[model samples]
Target: MKKRLDLAAFRDGILSGSRVVLGQAITLVESALDSDQELAAELIQSLMSHTGRAIRIGITGVPGVGKSTFIEAFGKMLLEKEKKVAVLAIDPSSQLTKGSILGDKTRMESLASDKRAFIRPSASGGTLGGVSGKTSEAMLLCEAAGFDVILVETVGVGQSETAVKNMVDYFLLLMLAGAGDELQGIKKGIMEMADALVIHKADGENLPSAKKAKASYQNALHLFPSSPKDWSPKVSLASSLSGLGLEETWREVLRYEYQMKESGFWESNRARQRINWLDEQIHYLLGQAFLRDSKVKQTMDHEMENVRTGILNPGTLAKKLVSLFLSTERPQ
Candidate 1:
């Protein structure tokens, strides 16, 4: 029999920046067990005072845009500056195997070995967005664990970008040279949400093309309405091979943080995110409670089959299920 995890020990270790305990804390939050969820909520409540100190940044790009490479270089640079970095890489789960491939430690060999950096790659698990549902929770845990910079890398499959954008302080879109915006398949709305656009793989012959792409994106960004933060979006070229644009990109991020903080937008944005998180959790918990009710689950298949066979209407089935769930003892 395994020893039960001590909540106090977890809390103390996290507040003291113990990576081992931090990993366990994240696992607790990600668990689907009722017991674990109860413990996770208590842990979050205790650690709430220690969170909100880190700079949360979401990094997304089109496939083949060298996202992992960029993060490797970028994270190493942050570590060089003595910043405590935590990367939550949201890996795209395979439809066939239902497992993640991109979050493997080999993808970020250098940064994974660093003492000041913590990297966690989580399977998206068919979540609506590229991010795992527990990403926000994990981020708060990281902050409580004393990480000052949190980098969230989305699956970059297009639809999940918006979900990641809402959770981060600054959103970065990585692009490749040559392909026009439309041809590249990036959604217009995603571009609008980005605080910066980084043209990746800008070494050797790609440098000129990267510069041209940078200019084009800068022009395109100018056409959009100004951001609420009063900070103009920036475009820069980056290359992991040559390490050309790491410094400038970090500088831009720092400048954006400074400007947003001065305008009070930083704190306001985080407050709004917390409210949004609350709403999301309510919806999720309600759905979970509905499905977990024994009465509902016992009738679910029958109701769905009725709807499928056209014997019952969808709306009628939903009402019946809701009523049945209400009759049960709901999870507290």
Candidate 2:
């Protein structure tokens, strides 16, 4: 028989900064089981006052952009300054098997081993946003547990990458130097969303190219309008191998944060994020409920068959399906 988790004990343990209890709380919130979800909601509600204290940053880049390496070095630097850091690393999951590489723990060796840092690498689980489905809840849990800095790293920049950007206080796009392509594999949309861009691999041999890339990016950013925060996005150079530019990158983030707070953009941005999260969750839960309705499932399959055989048009079938679902659904 499974033993019940003591909610009060867990709450106190997390508030007291017990890593073990914090890990358990994170795991509880990440679970998709119905029973666990009730407890998770309770846990989050209990810890609500303790959250939103951490500086949240979302980092993303292409495969070879050295995101993990940079995060390792950057997280270590923060830890050295007596700040507790939490890394919510999102790994790509397999479409066929839903399996994940789950290698961030191994990739971020130094930070993973550091007592001041907590690293949780989650599978994307085929989520549309380029992040784990429960990342926001997990982040709240981490913040409640006393993490001063929370770094969210996405699987890679793609259509769904904006999901992470919407959730974080700052969105950082890392790029490789000398890609030669004018856009360097970064889409204009994603590039515009970045609060800052760091050209990685700015070491000995790559120094010249990194500097050139910085100049090009700076010019391109000039063509774009200032961010809603009223601050112009800055581009910098970084080298995980040489540790050059890391401090500068951190400084840029701090500076941007300071400006946002001074302009009241930070509070408004967080408020907007909360509304977005609520809307997204409502859609997800409604979809799940629709799928779980046996009557709706049967009606949908029947409608799909009619559409497949050309007996019914898609628009008519969709309307009929929605009516059926609404009729059959139980009121909450």
Candidate 3:
């Protein structure tokens, strides 16, 4: 029988640059099956100090916007430049089986084949943010394993993107020029998170359409004024399939980094994300603890039954839930 996956040896394998072990470690973190969550948590603590070196870029877009395809192209380019790229993709999985659509891996076949790139697809599994508890921790593990670029790809257009933007140094929004599409389709708050907007799949038959979309985006962007750094958001068109306009996109990312550093948004953003993360996790833990109380559980059941019977008002039900939360002394 195979020995249990050894944590100590696994840790050493990470430090020693063993890709096989690195893959296992990443899988452990991404798979939040109830049994592994605690072990993954412990491993992340051990790997904490080794993180933060990678340039974390988070990419998101609406469904069918080619996020996976763009990542494949972008990742391959980085690999050709001899950079080790690791992708932590957060996409919802089937609740029953807890596996992603697995489309990311399929789209990123080339990147997967590259020696310099590591791709891990994580099942969101009803996770609100589409990120598991160990995402940041896994990032640290990847950084420690010597990956130069750690890419956190999240499901687009909602809480998932918001969650990813909080953790990454740069947030990238990918757009496409479908028939008569408008910026109105994307929420303003999500657009505001973007450090840059890339018009993806800009090539051949799509080039002219992409250009028009780029102009429209530029016009829409003027409405946001400038970022806190006095930097106007950058917009560009790129063909992930044809490898066109990639270099400029990379340059813009670097420029954004420089502007952020110069204007102190770098540290400021990181600090804010830290506080936000702390608060979010605290609230989550508190809610979990509050619900775990036997009394609270019974109350919830009663409340739901009351709602079903039309005896309980929604507002009153919410109040009762909040009271339950408030009454509980949450453990730190």
Candidate 4:
């Protein structure tokens, strides 16, 4: 038999700032087993008061924009300011084998080795928006562990940015300079959602182009409607290698936070996000229940074959499975 988890021990270790315990707690929440999930829920609920103190920031960009390196530099800057930082780097998982590279720790060796920084590379597991299903939970755990800042790095493969944006206080979009038509590289919707834009690799010969890109993006952002928070998104240049513009980026984040909080939008937005989280949980639980229903499981293979052979339409088979699943809950 497996050893049971000690919830109190885990909670105490996390509150006391034990990195090992924090990592284990995060792993518990990431587990798919029903037993582990129950424990994870209890752990999260118990630590609810400690969470939400950290500034949650979502960072996304085009591939090759150097997100991991940028995070290392940015995180190190925060550490210099006597702040604890947690990075949740979401890695793209393979569709065939479901394996992920999980190499952010390796790429961010300096930051990973820092005693004040926590780097977690989680597999996306085919989740839309390039974020793992348990990412928000992980963020909560990190916040509970007393991290002053939480940085969520998305897979940045043109997936929906809404998921990360909704969970974060600031949404940062990193862009590469001299990369073909800059405006055409990403969806305008993603741009509109950004709290700030940083043109990375703004050193050496790339400096000029980075500046030009910043100007172009600044102009484009002017056309979009102002955010409800009454804050304007700014575009700036940064270089992870030379450590340029890191402080400015941090200042921008603080400015946005200060402005939003002063206007009461910060608290209201977080409340709205919590409600959205509840809705997502409901849908997720309903899907899980539907899949686990004995009737649905027994007939699923037959229904799939029927649909494959064109004997039954997919919509009809779906409705039939839902009906069967629902009927099981009805009183006999």
TM-score of the candidate numbered 4?
A: 0.90
Writing each residue's lDDT as its tens digit, candidate 1 over 240-279 gives 9999899999999999899889989999998998888777
Q: Model 2: how far is 104 from its true place, Å?
A: 5.9
36-61 per-residue lDDT for model 3 (tens digits) = 66677777677778766788899887
- Per-model lDDT: 0.83, 0.80, 0.76, 0.82
- Candidate 3 positional error at 132, Å: 4.4
Ranking by lDDT: 1, 4, 2, 3
> What is the Cα root-mean-square deviation between model 4 and the actual structure?
2.9
Q: List the residue pairs that clash in candidate 2.
A: none
Check candidate 4 and list the clashing pairs: none
N/CA/C clash count, model 3 = 0
State TM-scores per candidate. Answer: 0.91, 0.92, 0.86, 0.90
Clashing pairs in 1: none
CA displacement after TM-score superposition, residue 33 of candidate 2 (Å): 1.5
